[model samples]
Target: MLFRNVISILLIFGTPSLVLGCGFPPDLWCSSPEISEKCGVEKQCSLWHSKQALTDVPLVRYELYYESLCPGCKQLILTQLYPAWLKVQSIVNVTLVPYGNAQENKYGGKWNFTCQHGPAECVGNLVETCILSILPFDKAFPFIHCLETYNPSTDGKYCASLYNLLSYWPSIEECSTGPNGNSLEHDMAVKTNALNPPHQYVPWVVLNGVHNEEIQSQAESDSLALICNAYQGVKPAGCTKTGFIRSPVKKIL
Candidate 1:
């Protein structure tokens, strides 16, 4: 008999809804503010207190490095991990780092990595980070909702659609050419090597200045668990089957 560990957290109103799908069943979590309509008063009050305690803690900066084309990155973001981050919004400074040059190359109109996709990249990262940075817990829901419904694809129109969805607009020519032309490519290669030190994979996530390789391995569940553990301080027990273990967050930090 295989025993799966399912952690269920009931988030009361006023709490950011993170951890929607990582390891907890979606049915077990509720976002509605009316406690009477969603959960018992006792559970609601308890969750409220927990949320307060969580919010009082100092925020930790976390960077997630991923490729736009990687399915594992998509899974981790759209699934429970991202939701969990939402729950702890007051305590997390989340940064989305687009790792690797492939997707940017494939979409941003420049094959060689030239131009200042830096502003675009920085914009996207800062938007998410800013919401998590300044918005009240209850107000950040729409961003997460939009991210959940995002379509992950690299086809010209598909990528463009997502960019627009994020309110990220590239020039018509830039859209056709890609994010980083030859110039950005040269800069990225140099920067990635300086930062990531050249690994053999893609989708590496840096959490609190720690880079976990699970993303590169396409270990979606494992990466999610590792991310959860990093933020929640609870070791994930069921992710070994998915190929993740307790390792350094990379040597860069």
Candidate 2:
């Protein structure tokens, strides 16, 4: 009976749904050169923030704690975040946290929660977390960028195939929408729920644990510039050419 009950929580479908988001903090994230890249060069499958970061190097940690289906979240990912990745994939590491402002009510191994955008957002977050679990960012981010294009509410499965990630969709879906999926989200909640100052809204954008109000304000138009500015390493040529150093981003407490 205990085993069966545990299974129920792990596999239980969403009985209800919720929403969640961003906030301020400090050092915000530490760097440990002792730890290697978040994922190794060989390309092991793991969560986005899996590895320990090297603080000594010039690195800008862009962590987006967001809900899946939020309109603003969708816009920023496609415009600012995606383009930023293309330009600075070598210099920056972006962490996508799907447990926006939502609360997770744990039942055994199963997690029941609600999202602001409704059930779809909750479902979408699970799907995204599952993808990151198995695929590295280079392969996974493209599919995610495309999935949001057609509206995740209805075309999540189709987008997977469209982006050529179809081969992995079966496993992805099984883990995302099932007990396995629940387990992943539960872990993510543990991380997101512990944000230092707590989030005020979705797309709670942070750079190295520092929430920059200025960058968040102009994320779409100036994200790359902001990241480039935060970069402490040797500046890229593009940074000089643009002549656009974003205004200092303010970190909230």
Per-model root-mean-square deviation over C-alphas: 15.0, 19.6
lDDT for 104 (candidate 2): 79
lDDT of 2 by residue, 184-216 (tens): 888889888888767777777888877656656
C-alpha TM-scores of all predictions:
0.40, 0.70
Best-matching candidate per TM-score: 2
RMSD of 1: 15.0
| Candidates' C-alpha lDDT | 0.41, 0.67
TM-score of 1: 0.40
Residue 105 displacement in candidate 1 (angstroms): 11
